[model samples]
Target: MASPVSQKLEEKLVCSICLELFRVPVTLPCGHNFCKHCISDHWHKQEQAPAGAEKGYTCPECRRAFERYPELEKNVTLCSVVELARDGEARVSGTERCEVAHGELCPQHGRLLELYCEDERQCICCVCSIRQCQRHRRVLFEEERSKKQALLKESLEKAQEESERIKQAMQELEERTRNIKDSSEGLRSVILSKFTLLRKALEDCQWRTVARMEQEQAAALGHVGENWSLLKDRLDILGQHRERAQRLLACPDHRAFLQEFRLLPSPESPEALLPVEFDVASVVEPIAEILTNVSRLLLEDLPGSVAPKAPEPVGQDHRNLTFNPETANKYLELSKGNRKATHSPGTVCGRQEQGPRFEPWQVLCTQGFGHGHHYWEVKVSSHSVILGVTYHSLPRERQQGHKFNIGLDGGSWGLQVREDCYLAWHRGQAEKIQEPLYKNLGVSLDYGKGLLSFYGLGERTRFIHSFHSVFTEPLYPVFWLCEGRAVMLCQRD
Candidate 1:
């Protein structure tokens, strides 16, 4: 059923060396057709022959001898004929030429898509390319497929890299989360232990105070009983004298009355009654004093005065904190080994700016903390003082208003003790601490959890207030005082 022209085209498309339809057909100078790979293999065998025997290289179809393997050029005309023959053969055998539904074939030419519109990134039949994509870039179907594969590979590689980065980030986040949980657990244990010790001390103090009150009451009552007995004896003597006098008066015999009077030995003058002093005030005053002293020891000075037994500085070893002389205000006078800051009446002349110092009566601690928890104590003399923490970047120059003052505005957090109550201040906001007045205050900072807690030190530590946030910079303990106010940082024992 082969047409004449088709048979002739097939003859031209066949490779003589392999006697098969040409694959990558190459034409020698002698006009012989051969597959490029077949001709190269034929010549490779010739070259492998003995040196002198290699001279008989020739075209396989014509047996035309050549000096060497002839250079070959791909036969462009034969290449086109091969494609046409292939399509015709497929049609004669009734093969499905179009992969998609025949309905989607080019309406005018009835051909399957064999080209791609590069500008549109779409596939099209040859007729559609000429009609619609004439001015656009075009490529054969196989060529476009090759390009697409390369692009897909590049995209896939980028995705893999991004996925790996995301995985690494996730792992880092999980590790940080675990660290936080572990740190919190350890902190919780320490906090509980310290609180337990405080509770135990308070209980012991309560028992001692109660026992003392009971003992005082017992002694006072015994002394009152002795006084009562003495008064009773005096009353009895008076009663006996009254009876004798009445009997004598009523007696008919005057001689008996006179005789009794003389024998009576002059009724002993009644001893003067002395007052028994068992007032509630005397009992209560001493008990109150004892309680106050115990509470003050436990709350205010317990953590410092007890040395190694005192609660360890949270999350760190004990450290002695003192005012940084370089950062002290001109009106502040440091004494007691530089641990105390007394608000002097006048500023010293020629106060050079050393780093950063407070302008309106403030000073910073010697050490600055960037991480972990820290705790320190300050002993204040009166309510006209402020104790707090601030970042190193906090403004050191005095401002016009109280906006930059510690416990009054941003960049610092403070506890201001007033005659009436305690105020915790941050960013211009104030929260009153309802706890009782305290002279010694303890400030604790947990940088990890962004917590700053204040406690009134007494027989037991009383929570005053806390500020919570994610601190973005290093924090240093800061203090504010007016004239006549004095504050001391308790030395670590």
Candidate 2:
């Protein structure tokens, strides 16, 4: 509602002649104001008055006559006033009244708080708006509150979603923790069983060694006992001879002594005894060699064998994937339960119109990986094949000046098999790596660790190249084959 003071001021500023707010207000000699154009047009009409009509100029608002054509002068002060009034009205007329909740009253006016002063961030009444908050921005209290409520709801929803995500992540981590513990326990059991067997074998070897040493010791002691017996017998025989000789000498008969000496012929020299001893070195040398071998084994291999190995840069998730026929180009043929994709030039397969098929000589796999380790192997018929992984965002159109679009941008990576060497391509760049052509190739995608590795699958899986990047989208295995070349997705149960 317009205040009385503003209403009266507006009435004063209005041009009564035109019945609207003055524009370029001008004052005439009759002390009345009107729009300059309105007054001029009125006098121009008077100048063209009919011959019978009164030919004079008069004020349209006051109806007072002027003797001569009064030169119109602009009412500058009144014009300024009218402009101020209209501008103020334009702002004040946007709204009439608003009722605030909670029965709050404006502190300045002691009136109901009908409006919200956005600039002041407070509630106000009409009186206060017209007085202190005339130039301030204001809105209905409910309007501002609704905006705040919307923001609060959005924030709350986001927070709730975040909480749910966090909880899910926590649960996954807990499950992984349990799995780790169980695996550790199982591995411990296996290691313990192996060590126990090894210990038993070692103990058996020790017992056999000790038994051999004991046998050697007994043989040596028997030989020593035999030699001692022989020596003792000879010593007894010599004593008997000595007694016989003494008896002869006591008989005081040289003849008797000579006969006793002849009869008691000189004792035969003691038989030569072979020296015998337990050959400890012979017994221990074999064990020492075994110990030496064991020491070398522990030094050279035990550290690696006794514990789990470090993480492999590549993995063997061994996913069984097939070609996605829907995304295969017309020139490509899928066979063998869609596990093989062959490029047959001039062969057009009937395809749906506007289908999501590649224009290039390329095909995608049915499976895609977003996280964790994933691996797949492929057997190529010949060289000139490109194997890699690509985001779904890869364009289906043929690249300019190229038959295939794989590894042309940030969305894909490729290892192109050439006749001489392999080419690692990404982001419009190619790196030439001279190597043998691997007919059987493997690809490993470690999504969680952001590693994509290509391998040459021979007797041993050989690392060819790898891509390290932060992957945002799930990656699908993609391949491009040259004419007359085919690729088969190796299946592992």
Q: Of the candidates shown, which would achieve the greatest TM-score relative to the real structure? A: 1
Estimate, for each residue in 1-493, the C-alpha lDDT of model 2 and write its tens digit.
8899999988887777667777667888768888776788889999998899998888876688887999887675776577566653343221211312235544554444557888888887656678889999988767899988999999999999999999999999999999999999999999999989988988898899889989998899989998898888988998988887677778877777777667667778889985888766577656654653464455445776442122333446678998888899998988859998888888887656545899888999888899888877889999999999998878999889988999898779999999999999887889898777889887877787566777787676676776666566789999999999999988765
User: How far in Å is the alpha carbon of 397 misplaced in model 1?
Assistant: 48
- Candidate 1 per-residue lDDT, tens place, 1-493, comes to 9889778878877777667677557888787888777888888787788866745577888888888657777665575466466663243122323223665455455554556788978776545666788899987666888999999999999999999999999999999999999999999999999989978987886787567667867777777777788778878888888887787778787788778768774567665654555544354444543553454465445675532123333435445787888888888888857899988776572456777667778888888887887788889988878888887877887767672377554458888888889888876778777778899888888777566778887887777776655465788898888778899998766
- Alpha-carbon RMSD, each predicted model: 21.3, 30.7
Question: After best superposition, candidate 2 residue 153: deviation in angstroms?
Answer: 99
In candidate 1, how many clashes are counted?
Answer: 9
Poorly placed runs, candidate 1 (over 4 Å)? 1-110, 141-147, 266-493
For model 1, give the RMSD to the true fold.
Answer: 21.3
Q: By TM-score, how accurate is candidate 2?
A: 0.37
Clashing pairs in 2: none
